[model samples]
Target: MGIMGCCSDFLQRVKPYVAMISLQFGYAGMNIISKVSLNHGMSHYVLVVYRHAFATLSIAPFALILERKVRPKITFSIFVQIFVLGLLGPVIDQNFYYAGLKFTSPTFSCAMSNILPAMTFVMAVLCRMEKVDLKKIRCQAKVVGTVVTVAGAMLMTLYKGPIMEMVWTKHVHPHRSSAPETTDSSDKDWLKGSMFLIVATLAWAALFVLQAVTLKQYSAQLSLTTLICFMGTLQAIAVTLVMEHKPSAWSIGWDMNLLAAAYAGIVTSSIAYYVQGLVIQSRGPVFASAFSPLMMIIVAIMGSFILAENIYLGGVLGAVLIVVGLYSVLWGKYKEHKENKKSKVMSLPLTLKNSEGNGEGMDIKDEDEKGKKANSMNLSTSDDRSTIKVRFPIPEIPMKVEAPNA
Candidate 1:
């Protein structure tokens, strides 16, 4: 019996780590394919359009079949939320990501994406979804972690050091340089790509907050996923038509390009998303996100070793900082959870102190006893210093739903 219990405990611990690793690999695969497609001369606008179209086509049928026996009623408010979510994330986010990839290497783009969590934290606070008090260690940790993460992203993007310059000069030599003027023009392209990727990250952070809010109202993840993709496809197609003026860029009939589009749309966007929803339901959102930093490392190594791309020192350090910041936030939250558990265990006495305060003035002995009891109730002597405290009542946890048929 002891051995069985131990094994079950082991499995529980391993599950989240394994899920996070899988999510990272999925994201890494996305970076690789998106980069390769751009290298093959596909424009960013075209890629964005194809991605949504493919994702929508892939997710719609499966979602329908999953909920076919009992379809989820789609309300207007839910549709509005989904529309905004998809527009911010898939439509705008992918557009910026691809544009960034177009100007810079895939590795660079992926590295920049590491700032998403920090951005999400800030945005969540601004949206009044998250509250923190700096006096508390948890809130302080989060603030420091968020600031460090943003600083790391900026270091990777804006600051070009001797190492980066040396690497760029030594390794990345453009073979077909038309003129010095043309070279400067190409440099501008990389800059534009970097800026666009940053925008994408910000948009993605917004999307995350929105999804967290939207999840409250909508019970059907699959149904909402389908609707958003459907709407986003329409929006992206419209964008492509207006922006992509070149005849060659817009001509999408039949080829490897189409296959790439199909793969991105069906596999990466649709099926992968469904898999993500399942994983999130089984585990949680934070567990899903914790694996994302791994994508940066994978993309970096693959780009450097396999594709012979330059690995700048700033990139490496920035990646390290981002990962550090990510785990710091996660650890801070974990610590906060433990403290809250302790508080709840101690709250019974504190509740007593408040409720049992009689109208008649107490004697010194009684008052002293009450103070002692209140002190015992508090696990931390530093309670006065704790400005922010997150109290999670038992009622807040989501009720579990049985998995849909695979």
Candidate 2:
């Protein structure tokens, strides 16, 4: 039992880290696969439609089975929040993200995405979900981190230094869809792509804030994800129909598109959302968004080999700044968490002392003395009418003498 308890405690401590890593890997895989699918002429709207349709299907079973008993009643207000969440997430965020990827490389897209932590931090503070104590080092670290992260994202978008081309990608065709092919075109398209990604990240941050708040009202993680997927499917389908009039554009078969949709739906959309909901419930939106840099790193490494991406000096510099900023925010949060724990630990002894308010610390003798004092007070009040001098005040007995028989 003792060994089992220790193992359980260890696992509890490690669970959030494991969940965040899995979420990052899933996101990295989705980005790579989505880029490939788009390169093969998959429209962003059509992809969103298929992605959420499959996500709904994948998550429905879990929502029905796991949350069958414990799920709360979904009120009208909750439904509206979830609907808006779908719009910000699958509609605004993912769609814009995919469109931006079409105009830019996967590595650059992921690099720009590193601002999510800062964005979430700012939004969370605005929403009052997070507190900012500027006097504390934790708050200072977070402020500096947010500034550094946003600066890194801006540098990544505006500056593209000479290509630090990878040796492994030498065999891949130079004209592949992985890169924009020229600095001239890249400059123009970088602005366009950055605009879209900015919107995507904003929507992403808004969704994080909304999801965190909504989860407080509705605790069922799987059900809420299923609802988001369902609403997102409808919303995406509507948008896709209006934008992509040709039925041929929606025609998907046994190809990379299908594979991408399947993987993204099940792994990234469904499981990632479910796990993130749990993480947010345990931690918060900022903590969940903090792991985004890992996704950037994974996609950078994978995009180099899979998509034949060229890593540039500007990209490397921006990546370093973003990573440093991310750690700064995390370090601040860790320090704040430690201080909070310390405060709780210190307060516990004071609470115990206040509740057990004996002149000395509580013991068996103190309890016995209390009982004897109560009995003596009863006898004195009943038989002997005299004054009593009390060092420690008693509520029932007066400190001054009150001679009732006089």
lDDT top scorer = 2
lDDT of 1 by residue, 1-406 (tens): 9999999999987876776677667667677777777788888788777777778777787777887766656688877888898799778998888888877877788878878878988998999988899899888888888888887887777654433333343345444133233256765786677789889999999988998888788766777777777788788878888998887897666765676677777766777777677677776666676777778877876665445556667777877788888777777776776887799987763222112333222121222223333211222222332222222223246899999999
Cα deviation in Å at residue 138, candidate 2? 0.7
Q: How many backbone clashes does candidate 1 have?
A: 2
Identify the leading candidate in terms of TM-score: 2
Per-candidate TM equals: 0.75, 0.80
**Model 1 alpha-carbon drift over 4 Å, by segment:** 1-15, 69-72, 162-186, 253-256, 340-406
| Global lDDT scores for all candidate models | 0.73, 0.83
Residue-wise C-alpha lDDT for candidate 2, range 206-311, written one tens digit per residue:
9989988998999888899899989988998888888988989988899999998999888988888778878977987558867888888899889988877778
C-alpha RMSD by candidate, in order: 14.4, 8.4
